[model samples]
Target: MLLPNSKRILLKLSGEVLMGEQQFGINQETVAELAREVKAAKDTGLEICLVIGGGNIFRGMAGAAKGMDRAQADYMGMLATVMNALAMQNALENLGVHTRVQSAIQMDAVCEPVIRRRAERHMEKGRIVIFAAGVGAPYFTTDSGAALRAAEMQCGALLKGTSVDGVYDSDPKKNPDAKRFDTVTYDKVLADNLKVMDASAVALCRDNEIPIVVFSIREKGNLARVLAGEGVQTIVQGNK
Candidate 1:
């Protein structure tokens, strides 16, 4: 997929990917590999920000379903994301890639608070900033947080790194004949409920004119390839 000219991007990764082959929790080796891929992309001179989900550890909706207070459950979910961010930060730093973890829910002792200007400056100095805590509020997913940060940072594109290669017409896991789309319109995604992202996230990207590129981050060296416009990915854009 040929993406638009994106000098800066916000990459959203699901917490499940950190599980690797495990049923739950983070796999250090896998995270190390992902960090390398991200480093490669950064080496290409593209500024990057990251937002990671907390599904592997906890899901707010699931907690709510179990009769927990919605807001409290969501807060736990947000903390899970912060943990993931810390793990990612460790991996990236171990690879000798300078990184910073910025949280929407401030824990100044652990990470810096969300400050757009500081984050921009970090990127300018070649440091990757990881945003955590999912918009710092309840009733929102990390997907929405990614979209919001992408818009706030004026990222050229929003990269969704998942286990799936691209966006499929149906649940590819269940439907063997499911077709993957190389290019899809944001409206089509929203209208069809493609599950590429939450409707709010998709709408935010659409409204901001930022493309969403969905690709498999599990694949070795794929992040760089996708950023270079030569990898398998689904590009979601305005009426594409």
Candidate 2:
């Protein structure tokens, strides 16, 4: 229940969350559930912006490892993000939540190009703006995009919904002794390799002084709880 501020927020969702019980692609039922959560959150009157990753369908680095050119692979990854945005837009609209997909790579055929002021206007009008594509460039994960979008929109914090409840000293899945942290300094996370996020993402957020909340998105109401400071999660903050 300890928010740094009551300003608008940017939510970063991994594409793997959309996979649900499937091995790949999207699961509409799960997406609907997520949309309902967003609807509830939006009902709280907090302006929200979204940035989703394309890992479910593909990751540029994964493709490049298989022989595709790095730039071409990254563009492919960007396209994957657009697909997710459209899917999310559909689910949100079905729930009566007006949403828009804005991509960094001008894709008018599918969605609007990312226009800062336009996205701001959308938020003002109570619409959720979902940002897609990986900064329209290669070699960067969506984490960087999320940080950039959060900064560009002046969001209070970056909510990174993940499978784990919070950041740990090591991979909890592999290391059962990896201690979960409720609060940590940004430098500590990077120095100790806590995997709070990628180095680039963490560096950008630390530079911008944004708190990163890492929590479980599958815990039903955890997002709301974390926003209220009642959830099990890690809070990575800038050092004094």
lDDT of each: 0.94, 0.89
Q: Candidate 1, residue 84: CA error in Å?
A: 0.6
Using lDDT as the measure, the top candidate is 1
Looking at model 1, residue 134 earns an lDDT score of: 91
Off-target runs (Cα >4 Å) in candidate 1 are none
Per-residue CA lDDT of model 1 for 1-240, tens digit only, reads 245577889999999999999999989999888888888888888899999999999999999999999999999999999999999999999989999999999899999999999999999999999999999999999999999999999999999999999999999999999999999999999989999999999999999999999999998988888887889999999862
Cα deviation of 184, candidate 1, in Å: 0.6
Per-residue accuracy of model 2 over 92-188 as CA lDDT, tens digit each: 9998899989999997888999999999999999999999996988888899999999989988899999788999888989988988888899999
Q: Candidate 2: where are CA atoms >4 Å away?
A: none
Q: How close is candidate 1 to the true structure, as a TM-score?
A: 0.97
- Candidate 1 clash pair list: none
Q: CA shift at 51, candidate 1, in angstroms?
A: 0.7
Give the per-residue Cα lDDT of candidate 1 at 221: 84
